[model samples]
Target: MALTFHTGEVGVSRAEVTSIVADALRREAFTEALVATYVWGKGKRGTPRGSGPATLQKILAAEGLDVALAAAVTVLHEHGSQEAYAALHQQIPELGPSFFTKFLYFTGKTLPPANGPEPLILDRVLSLRLRSLAVTVGRETGHDPDGSVAAWVWADWNWSPHRYGIYLSFMHAAARQLAGTDSWPSDAAPDLLECALFNSAWEPSS
Candidate 1:
């Protein structure tokens, strides 16, 4: 299906875009993959392109982008490593974890093995969910009983790499937990859970 923007503009169909991005990744066309991810995903929103495309242009033209993207691919699809994740954190100029992690998440979909936990989107919505859970757990455990710290850590944007790693692990674990159940499939991707949390409310179990 095509992801039509709120502006009533028709873009490429979802399957076509996914194939294009997957081919780009297989060809080591990181810049194209990144651009396709944004244009097809967030950029489709009615919001102005802003500095996003310009920033991407500058970063993609730089020499070190290949190294960063390559390492990200290796870690995300080949080895599934936190060390590489740390190294990739904010490596791209003007690109933050929120955006780059989306790239990684899409890459995980196109690529296989994941070698371990698959990468998934961790935008503000997902972080907010995590924050709510952290706060609830903290209250129950008497740690950060006021949830002040939890809210601070799970801010709307620019999360630290360590926190990003925590999100990946948490999401993958939750996906596994939901799988093989009555409603969730045994082979469901973690992104499914991420999307669910993004669209719903989170509350601590009593």
Candidate 2:
């Protein structure tokens, strides 16, 4: 569905979703990308969550909204350090790690990060999943034997750039490991792993 970012009006037609994203990527249109990603991510919950002209106005009015997005574009296209890219974005209000990460994920569809895994959405679900793994690993290793470091690093929200760096590194590693298995395609993108984890398939269900 097409989205009017200035007004936050949801457009008709499910088929437009792909086309809108395609158009955004084709032209590197930040506004269109913002609309497409936000609409696509919110899906059915947009309207009830107070997605309207007023809310959208607030979003657009946020100081450094445009500047931050511009920096994101540079980071994505130039393959700048992902941790610094993440740190650059954390200051923007109205856009959090969850949503802004979606924007990053969409914008970077054309180029993989130079030094690490491409940006993937790191919402609450994925963070908690990481938290569980951290707790387990902490238990096994003396480094975080009490899981306190795990809790601090993998908190449900407001993750630091260092933590984001760790997350990207881990996701890429997990993606590589999954590719080695018969069930996963060798060329599958890391975001596919992000999707799987978000869809209730975190780790092997054992």
Candidate 2 residue 20 C-alpha distance from true site, Å: 2.7
Clashing pairs in 1: none
Candidate 1, overall lDDT? 0.70
lDDT of 1 at 158: 78
How many clashing residue pairs, candidate 1? 0
Question: What's the CA error at residue 159 for candidate 2, in Å?
Answer: 1.6
Tens digits of per-residue lDDT for model 2, 83-177: 53564555766666766676777666654456566777777778877888888888877789899998888887767766777788888888888
**Runs in model 2 with CA error above 4 Å?**
1-19, 25-28, 44-56, 81-84, 142-145
Give the top-scoring candidate (lDDT). 1
Q: Cα miss at 141, model 1 (Å)?
A: 4.0
Q: lDDT per prediction?
A: 0.70, 0.67
Model 2: number of backbone collisions: 1
Worst 10 residues of 2 by lDDT: 44-53
